[model samples]
Target: MPLKLYLLPILTLFIMTFSSCSKKDSGSAVKPTEEGLKVSLTNVTEASYTAAAGSTYTFQAAVTSKLPSSGVNITVKAVTDPGGVNIPQNAVAPSTSGAIAITLIGLEPLRTVLVTVVITSTSNPDNTITKTFWITNKAE
Candidate 1:
């Protein structure tokens, strides 16, 4: 057999490979839009709160049905005065439920612990919702 026969088969396979990858219907489905999931939190409805100095307060959010049952995430990002209070970084919502809790320990009087709740659809991280809340340490 001529060497050209082997080269011919190899060239055909290479072309097929490239063509398969470029096809519009190469087993690829249209991706769903990142419209995001509907979500709501029953807790922390107030925009601002106050806590006595040297006290610990926990803000619990009640979220159910308003969000997806799976692939959901929640995070508490402290924007200011984190050093004056103890707080958490991030948490994942339970697959069966959407309940989030944020605990703040007040340290300095008159100082504010400002934070934002960053909720993201784990399936579509690009889709997100953020809410800002703050806690001011009350003076004696």
Candidate 2:
């Protein structure tokens, strides 16, 4: 009889403890979100680039980051080089803050070539941005 009485109190206490506990709304907790880098072609408007055959065009790009001083790495590549397009620097580390210069030379007359430029934060690999520019080499 006494054991039953003790067990009843203990069970009640356990139930009460659990009943008092409540779950918190996970949505209410603030989370830090990363805003990736922003990239744009400085010289060209509307991301369009054109150059005559046997001519060279310079594509100047600028990058901005939410986190300052986070060194950035840039990659400039022609989607398909048909033996006429030459990119001297495929990879570059900007000496200035997010200033990149990509020069494309059309050795011979060719069609439109898609050039892709990708910028990634050295500090955060996931923070990256890609921009594509179309280069057309028209016969002069």
Per residue, candidate 1 scores C-alpha lDDT tens digits across 30-131 of 656654545554444456665545555567655543565345677766544646445544454444356666665533566677767677776667767777
Q: Candidate 2: misplaced stretches above 4 Å?
A: 1-35, 45-49, 81-90, 94-96
lDDT score, candidate 1, position 76: 67
Per-model TM-score versus the true fold: 0.56, 0.58
Predicted candidate 2 versus true structure: per-residue lDDT over 1-140, tens digit per residue: 89987998899999999988978677885534567777778655536665545456676877665543656777777654455455444455653476777776543456666677777777667777888767766775
- Model 1 pairs whose backbones collide: none
Q: Cα lDDT of all candidates, in order?
A: 0.61, 0.66
